[model samples]
Target chain A: MNWILLATIAALLIPIYEAWQDENIWQTMLAFSSIASKTSIMILIVSVLRDDWTLGVVGVIILSVGNAALMLLAHIIRRTNEL
Target chain B: MSEQLYIIPIVLLLPLTGCMLVLQVNPYHALVIRGIFGAIAALVYVLFGAADVALTEALVGTMLSITLYAVAVRSSLSLRVGAIEDQLKAHTARELLSVLRATFSKHHLRLEIVPYTNLLAMQAALRAKEIHCSYVLSEPGGSPSPPGGGSRYDIQTRVSRLYEIMQAEVPPTKAYLRYIDLANPDKSTEVPIPEAMEGKS
Candidate 1:
């Protein structure tokens, strides 16, 4: 498997494991969000290192969108529980 | 003018001379002295038609050397943690003694115990314009104590501001931050612990 795929798999599983171990939901959410954001940046770094400018640009754009979505989701979840 | 060809080697020797002089003397006092000599040497070389050599020597010998020496001074000031702590403690004791000696002091005074850590000292020094930057060591899986928890948050915020400053002042390639965990010294360990039975003879 590609390193990116392996990283994504690890990122996805970490939150699940934390949740299973009865960790706080907010902490788990933060971990997941941080993982997503970091992974996107890591992919961009790898692409640039490989001299793949196109892939790097795409990775950055995707990362920006992913971060915004994650932040929005976190806010909504936080707000819904308060209501 | 074939005899003047020897001037090229002399031009190269100028920076070497500056290096040796600076190396022998303490940099704190000798930096300006070496810089002046180096600049004069570079000017002489430029007059001799060695423009490239002159330019490099002028930059590296004078400007870069002075900047590096200044940075060293600042780093030394910051890294003298033990001395700073002793000074701070002495100052505090003197202040308290003065307070005790005063008559008719009605104000309820509380002694605020400021925890003296390397991180705290660095931050104070930075704020006081004593040092430009300092590194903080963090360990993985380590939780902050109650008072330190707030201090840790403030340190992170300071670091983020420092990052912005570095990005503006330095080139993108040079503007980088690294977190080194001193507690967990080795990063290549596969297993944290070996099987219990493996240790049994």
Candidate 2:
């Protein structure tokens, strides 16, 4: 559990580093996805530590639906550019 | 106390450090940095055994807001043009480019021009979406679209507006208005998406 917390803290810095390094829209999107997945994983880890399935279910919902919404928003923005 | 308790302060401190780093980045990069900040906050929540709050942060803070920021970035306006070499050589075609520049400038759009070797090459570029609008010279009496046949095959979205501009501005030529089917408003040269991909979510 201690190692998991450390790993989560380490993973949280990646998007900040990426944003500081590059300004391209694609790079920003990749960073966002990395952060999303990492945070969801952290939620799953904490729920396990607490012996709580309800909290785990919330993490699972975010893991499945969150990235899809981001993808859909990207698609919509691309469509607006076409106009 | 368990050794895990020591990790809590470090976890909490990470977001504050990240916040300072985010402030250092430019506004465009800052938007991306905020997503990282949200994830770190979620991690801090997890360290406190507040799994529900961590889950909320992961969904609402990290993903949803990042998508919104990206959508804003993707809205920049642009237009692309493609033409074959022979068509570009025509005096009227150069005039057409000037007209296009003037017209698109009104919309504050940046135009990109690509030159191709032949009509087929231009068509291929159009299909690949390397360029939004393509121009080609067609010889009169070219039945199935001659190599240099004068025809502009445009995407459905931009075709009508382009046709209106061409009709009003471009001087009549021997092959003028030969290929575009203004007669039937619905026909498109490109094939629709495949059935298999269309059925997928």
Best by lDDT: 2
How would you class the docking of model 2? Answer: acceptable
| A14-78: candidate 1 lDDT, tens digit per residue | 54344233334466455545544554554454455446665465456545654554454455445
lDDT of candidates 1 onward, in order: 0.40, 0.60
Pick the TM-score winner: 2
lDDT of 1 by residue, B55-121 (tens): 5654565556655665554334221111123334454334432432231122212122233456667
Clashing pairs in model 1, backbone N/Cα/C closer than 3 A: none
Q: After superposition, which runs of candidate 1 have C-alpha atoms over 4 Å from their true positions?
A: A1-83, B1-24, B82-201
How does chain A of candidate 2 score by TM-score against the true chain A?
0.85
